[model samples]
Target: MKAYRMLTEDEVLQLKSQSCLADDWNNVLVSSDFNTAYVHHTRFSGNVKLGSFDGEFTLKGGIKKHAGLRHVTLHNVTVGDCCCIENIQNYIANYEIGDHTFIENVDIILVDGLSKFGNGVEVAVLNETGGREVLINDKLSAHQAYILALYRHRPELINRIKEITDFYSNKHASDKGAIGSHVMIVNTGSIKNVRIGDYCYIEGTCRLKNGSINSNADAPVHIGYGVICEDFIISSGSHVDDGTMLSRCFVGQACQLGHNYSASDSLFFSNCQGENGEACAIFAGPFTVTHHKSTLLIAGMFSFMNAGSGSNQSNHMYKLGPIHQGTLERGAKTTSDSYILWPARVGAFSLVMGRHVNHADTSNLPFSYLIEQGNTTYLVPGVNLRSVGTIRDAQKWPKRDKRKDPNKLDYINYNLLSPYTIQKMFKGREILKELKRVSGETSEIYSFQSAKIKNSSLNKGIGFYEIAIQKFLGNSIIKRLEGVDFKSCEEIRARLKPDTEIGLGEWVDVSGLIAPKSEVDKLLDGIENGDINRLDEMNTSFETMHQNYYTYEWTWAYNKIQEFYKLNSDEITVQDIINIVNQWKEAVIGLDKMVYADAKKEFSLSSMTGFGADGSREEKEQDFEQVRGVFESNPFVTAVLKHIDDKTVLGNELINRIGHLA
Candidate 1:
């Protein structure tokens, strides 16, 4: 609370000599440290307040300018200490400019009537005509948005969440906007009904209307040239610039949207990037990226996905007013020119390669490849489990987190073989077995969902799922008994017991945080029952769930082990643990060998066609080695081989400890 004093008559005379005018000189208020020396060519009206000109701003070229008002019109504005306001094309009204801030060059900054600054704005996501609407706020997380958009059947939860959001929005409503400390707003056009936070940098922006830039010293928001945003909230560490346009959107922390990217009615969460693309009514979860000008993501939900050039999807197919929507589960990829008809759900870590209109649902068959052949969808299940690219993606996500803010809004899990996908493998194995049981084993092709699975592909998929299940279960048991030396069968059985019973049921991936479905339902029930009524409380629950993922996962794995291996937990012995380790060693080696072979294909002779132009095969080999490196010595290949060796040694160490009992 800054105290302002009426300007002395001598000070008013000095200001008049400096060509400063006020509607009534008595209406102006000045701080005790306000000096009339730098106040020149400024017009003041309607109870304007001025702080002291006690600082200097250094420009990029090391040129210094003393902070004060020059050639500016301030109407009902309070200029804070050491601030500069100059050359406004129109008046700046109803704004509280913070200390040490610089505001210069072009257009009006005002709040007309009362504005909520983009909070509680209903973004009609997924089903654009109506149904799924997410009320976006400043601190909305991906899990919250996921529930808001998908869990519409529980009307009580939806109404309670919306009412909480509305209360928050109304609490923040104001008649005057604020521009915070250490901000730089230069050469910008109209800023209307926007609240700019601390350390924000806005330059050459065409317009910013009804928005909140929640910037701070740890993570500042950057708004660059030709950007236009309305009814939006740009969270900390986000950059929206370069002719990008956004309407009715919420961009979460550490996001990047630029290069003429356009989005509307969408929510982009942490680590998502968009450039030269367009998104409409889409929920883009963490790591969802599209970098092509011809790519348009519409009416879809995606996470950990990449869209190649000219990738597209048709939600309505010119019917039903664009209400149809689709979801590409986490870690999915689409090749160039690929397309899908809506009401489709692709499994996690799958790849789509061609145009398909079948609306195939592969949510149970994760890590597969969906291809189009003669207008029929071909399903190749669990093939991606052996893909080097899949392993690389899983390994890189944790390293590529862009969130620099100490306080992260979304708690993400980057494990590729978590209970979420492994449980899907369990269901997928059962589904494949059912398909084989119904269709004769001699049949050439079998149908499941809307895709066709060849007999060979089906058999191969079953084997793939089995190997993955073995690998995951073995991993859990090994990690649980990592350091313990068991002497007897009873000791081993006691060690195998789960720590908790909460994760005995199904699991789900809520955008990025993978946890038990029971836990998610428990939280939702709390929300509906009025036990968890605040946004912070919900986020705290999510954080707790994320922190305890492994504890809960072991519970889920314990149940599956009994089902998959037909073993009673109380009767399990040291010999059984040794056998599990041996099988795990085999599974790990098999997958690693497949990955190594996949890497070797990149170094095949045919891959050198365009290299070593007009040269012998020997010369081409040399050129290929020079550019792509020798096959055995390549980094990924060496890593895979090393992983095999490490896991083998690990399994033997455990076996050696328990071999006597076996």
Candidate 2:
């Protein structure tokens, strides 16, 4: 609400004397504090408004420059107070520059006609051949895009989401662009139809067109040298630097894409890091990191994934266009030089090694490994449940989150064993038991989904899945009865009952948020029926689900307890609870011992081969200890031992408490 008035005749003359020219002096309006002494060597046209330039800016080396317009051309622009606009190679047109900003050595910044600032751009993510186009807007979240891309079967729901996005885009369409306060745009080229936010730093960027940098004071964005971006919306706390190129993309909060990484028609959600890699039409969910120069991720949907060096995927068989796509569920990892033919689905927390041509689907067998030998795909199920690397990955993801914005777009769940993976393990156990029953228990190998599982692996998988299931269910029961003072068997049974029925049946991982499938369906129904019309309301619904996760999880676990233990909820007694608690104690101790054993392999003799080069065996052992620490004293090993001790005490305490009720 700044007031502007025409400059006095003497002020106009003084400005002219200071080497400033205007098409018509009457068209230029200035604030009360505007001084002719600070305005020099500038040309003004097309109804320009100038604010007070009464302050000076201090440089890094204690140099001071008075805030004013110098050696620049402005057309239909309003320059705010304390801003220094200097050395513009071409005119800045139709922009409202904010206070305390510095724009120097820029070429041609403008808003042409009416622009939506990339709000309505359709990003063809997940499937490269199109159809799964998420209309990316400023408020787009990973969970929203997940539904839009993969829930194509619900056409009405898709149309509703598109309508909401289109409405948002149209509402924000403007004829004039804006640069917020405290922004610095230096040595940039051709910024057209872009809206830059507060505290943003843009330096040496080649071109940025039709985008919105949603930066703020709390979480500023930095776009650095040689970066070229088009039709994108980069959220707060992100850094795009070092010759990176992106087109038709929506980068979420705290993401980093740099070092010549190139992406086209993709959606990268929160905390995703891509350095020196190329991605095309991929839906990179939260924490999908690819740091290799030779790795190419295309036509895939991934979350909490890590792609190793030289890892690649094929999107076509060469007969048709590149129409195939694949999904690697959360926490899946690919080893170096690994390859997977598209139209496949790898389960959650699975490790992939070598190359495989067959389209194997291991969605029911999580925490496993898919290794290739002599071109044959071998499935080792539930082995990753005991891997030290898997535990470390689970422990590190939450610590690695870099989003500083208070309003995070993506809702991430960091639990390694939730209802989502536990359900898969439950099905995996059933599938293994069925295989053993059908193939005479003595079969050499069992074939499933074009992959082979040896008899030993199958039996071991059953045992592993059972242990994990017991652990999860036991955890739920113990937590449910944590502070309850149940003195009788009836009170224990009453306490064991679920509070709600919302978590029965199946659950899904919507990007990172894990919730019941029934609830997700209800949300989709609301969207389809026009009950949920705004983007904010949809995000609010997701937040509600995230907030009530434990409540819903207890319901699912309650139902599974009855089925797994063959008990009726009303007729259950304290003796049944004690038996379940005893089994849980054994499961917890068994898994911890397995993890301890797996961690010991890292310090084995074979792992010390490359250590202590140019030394004898004793020296090699010494060097390995110096570099990697002793096996008994390593941090992860200590944590594992502590976990074992804590869980053992917890199980015994719970068992003793339940025994008193009997």
Candidate 3:
């Protein structure tokens, strides 16, 4: 870390003779031992400084380039020695170039005026009509944006957030830009008013203006050919390449945007991926992915969602502009060609299929399906609980986290069944019962939330939700009992009791982090009171909530169990516990068997059609076996079998432990 020093009269004379002109030669500064030999074929104007760059850089393809100035013009710039800067079509101005930086074949790199590198840029996310604008910054998190965009009813809080962002922007505003050490910029077009960080690699990029590439040695950013970015802040470990266009956006850590993806007025949080798709006014939370060309996500807020090919949403009716915004809670998915009208809310882990025009709202029914059949929106609630895809998604999310940076901005929870969805199940069960009571028990179709639920489906949904609740509560109890040798029933009851009252009410997923509603409200109250002012403080709250999720969940689950089984936990006997364990064992095994059956569908005759194209019956069978493998040997199938075995053994063990009291 060398400190900049003032230039002496003799060195200023030599620089003047070298055709470097400054407003005042005294304004041009240098390090104490700046070398005059490194400044060559470069014209400097305005106040400038120079540093000793005594270093060599090797290009990606083994092209050796020395550090020195050549064929460039600078204004109010500081050029370090041992840096190779050449062929700038326009002048490089108001910049401090760091040592050993390799710059070649760039059209221009300049700070035209005072700028903050895209901070405080208002991104009209979720609603294009602009009521919910998120102030973009280098450190913006999904939770902060969620509050700013969705909590407009609290105008004072929103104003406070806006003021905080404005303060950050003003504090960061500077007339001079900075390019960090070991940066490589080659074959890039105009780069104006953007700050480049250390070890960044920019090649063949088209226009980049009013942005900050927050790259570093630990997590460098790579901007590749034909990309055009404006009004953006790209975070560390991200790759923006292959003709992608971004405007008014923040690409968070370890995200991938390439293959002609275009985004505007959107905020993509940690580990998101967008390729060959278009997103507008979307708040894409962690792991929100759209990789198909036909997928167009607009005016929606989502997290941990996978948009299938041809998935589209309609935000505007003919009367109004695209003012409507929708929310698909975490782990939601849309099938191919599925369409959702905005102003709708779909629940977590639910699947949307077909073009639904009924404007259905199923936020209380997680793990369900909204399917349009013959223009009728049919709801199959809670059926997704046994789906193999749902299980696989839960199993894969933690392993697939793309963020490798040590300093993760967003704290993500990947649980499929948290208090968030479990509370929804409680509501879903009640909703189904209310539907059954209002309609005749024998009615063929019952209507709820703009969707039709058949008599059988409604009853089955209630059953499914109950089973899921049992499983979750059973899991919580077993976990609480783990490593504990309970000698008395009172001790067992104490161990199973919740540690906190926070989990007694509903829960919500703040993007990828799931927590109790009371906890989220506490965070909101803190924000309103200006207690949580910084982004780091907000994220810390979310992390704290995530870490305490299980404690809160037990509170909720313990209260629900008395209502579910008609036996209060304080009065529950050993026989009651045995009954609950037996029910849980059945539910777990039944769900696993359903999943196994569903996975077997992949090996059916219909699934083998394309695999054995040119083969006879025996050959086709052999080909299918060779390519798809036997269903019995599939990894998921084996896991399902193991799960059944493990659950049975555990249930028997628990039953025997309480058998004496029984």
Q: lDDT: which candidate is best?
A: 2
lDDT of 3 by residue, 1-662 (tens): 76777777787678667765566766667787777766666776788777775766777789776677767887888776567888888889899887678899899899987999999999999888899999988778777888898889999889888887888888889999999987889999999999999889999999999999999888999999999999999999999999999999999999999999999999999889999999999999999999999999999999989999999998999787898889898889999999998889998899999988877789999898999999888999999998999999999888888776787788788877777788889899999998888887999999996899988888989988988888887776666666656688887777777777778777777777777778888888887898977766777888788778777777887887777789777887777778888888988988889899989898889888877678688888999999878889999899999999999998888878767766
**lDDT, candidate 1, at 175:** 91
* Over 4 Å off, model 1: none
> Model 1: per-residue lDDT, tens digit, 568-604?
8878777777878889999999998988888777888
Candidate 3 Cα misplacement greater than 4 A, ranges: 4-26, 79-82, 656-662
RMSD of each: 1.5, 1.4, 2.2
> lDDT values of the candidates?
0.92, 0.93, 0.86
lDDT of 3 at 15: 67
Q: TM-scores of the models, in the given order?
A: 0.97, 0.98, 0.95
What ranking of all candidate models by lDDT puts the best one first?
Answer: 2, 1, 3
- For model 2, state the Cα shift of residue 368 in Å: 1.0
* CA shift of 605, model 2, Å: 2.0
Question: Model 3, 169: alpha-carbon shift in Å?
Answer: 1.8
TM-score of model 2 vs. true structure: 0.98
Give stretches of model 2 more than 4 Å off: 60-63
Q: Give the winner by lDDT: 1 or 2.
A: 2
